[model samples]
Target: MNVAASIADFETLPRLQRARGAGRIAVGQIAGRTRLRTLFQEGCAKIRLPRPTGPAVEAVLINTSGGLTGGDVVEWQAEAQAGSRLSITTQACERIYRSSGGAAELTTRLRVAASAHIDWLPQETILFGQSRLERSLDIELEGDATLTALEAVLIGREAMGEAARDACLSDNWRIRRDGRLIHAEATRLTGADIERDASSLLAGCNAFATLVSIAPDAEARLEKLRPFLATLPHAGASAMGERLVLRFLAPTGIALRRSLQPAIAALSGAGSVPRLWTI
Candidate 1:
């Protein structure tokens, strides 16, 4: 069957998408407004950002594909205007299903205007056996804009006694401010080879998370947050210029999330947390 038909059939097949296989793409966006306070848009659907106090505007996208085909693509984007605050989070862990012979790709883009703030917080991505998934994220910021974002991945479901015995995963991230590149990172992992290089790749941990923040005085803030990071069990941080990067290697997703909260609080200064995270 064709891809679209396959997806429809899989959705109706009940156990197929969840048990054996499937591919899906979801997109969402939230913006700050004068009268409404905030606004949200998803794929063609729109909703007014609910009022009351909350962390910046936030959105989440999930891919339910049991695996990817030769031409599968997923895309997401977000933008925050001057003086506006927004935070985005994923509803659940992303699942990259087993692949037969093709590869899957996910691309994300974000833009933050001057004096605006944003938190791009997404849940972990879980890769099943024989899964081949490539993911990329790009962030563009106006001078003086601030951003804090996190990306986490788990190689196989350790809780389910699964290990990345035969999986290919590639991830890339880039951040730019005022058209100047500030940070770039990339990683690729596959099969037992990745596990053999565990010491250098992920310190032998099945779960890992990276948090990055960009601001005018990000270096100073990173230093201030360093002391707080030392309080976490398995977290470390580094800073360069207006960019700060933090990494956590843990045995489970809950541990990784716990390590991330305080770090984000220290860097963002907004006591508010993303609501999607609580769910």
Candidate 2:
């Protein structure tokens, strides 16, 4: 076998891109104020900033590879100690490119202490053509703790006039409070099912978002959030007990963000969205 043929043989084999990341954050007491006590990370993921923002600590997550493709693995874990207030966001959007091999996987786990407050607000996840992604999130909240999490999924690149064909996405979320499961949501979209179920499930929208807020005041704030939902072309808002759920669908990410901007700010109870939000 010649050297050129030998090298060509090696190149013909499947090429795999792999990455593993883990992050940990814990709160502690600092002069009678809650502060981060432990922050650990490994692999391609890093915590860009873990600083104090008003009454809470804000943490920004970063992925150095710029994007995730086939066979990539990513994981993040965060914990807020008792009486702590923590806010988390990503530095930019997570792009999922086409996968010729196995699916890319992502795992996230969150723990909130009693009387603590957490805001898990990351940017969108853009899916490219023929991409495959599987993700799971598990959250544990103490009896009096509060949590707010947001996720946005974009089917394709709008500016490039791309389309998501043969893409697969599976997302599962489990939320528990006081050792009891309160909410569980699972979504699976296979290759053909993407365009097949669009009319009924997604209303032909290529982009969508889900935001959940759980707190003692969640129900009481429903009235304040209703007006925001009424303005969207496609949106739904509901409050049940300690949980407030918001759903959005739009033709593009920009449209969806605009439609959800008012509701997001209202539910977050902040003057603005997360600092990581693009524009």
Q: Please identify model 1 stretches exceeding 4 Å from their true place.
A: 1-52, 62-71, 194-197
Q: Pick out the ten consecutive residues of candidate 1 with the lowest summed lDDT.
A: 18-27
Q: Which candidate number has the best TM-score?
A: 2
Itemize residue pairs with steric clashes in candidate 2.
Answer: none
State the displacement of the C-alpha of residue 171, model 1, in Å, after optimal TM-score superposition. Answer: 1.0
Clashing pairs in 1: 22-66, 56-85, 56-86, 56-87, 57-86, 57-87, 58-87, 58-88, 59-88, 66-97
Clashes of each: 10, 0
Cα shift from native, residue 6, model 1 (Å): 22
Candidate 2 TM-score, C-alpha based: 0.91
In terms of lDDT, the poorest run of 10 residues in model 2 is 263-272
lDDT at position 120, candidate 1: 78
RMSD (CA, Å), candidate 1 to true, equals 6.7
The TM-scores, one per candidate, come to: 0.77, 0.91
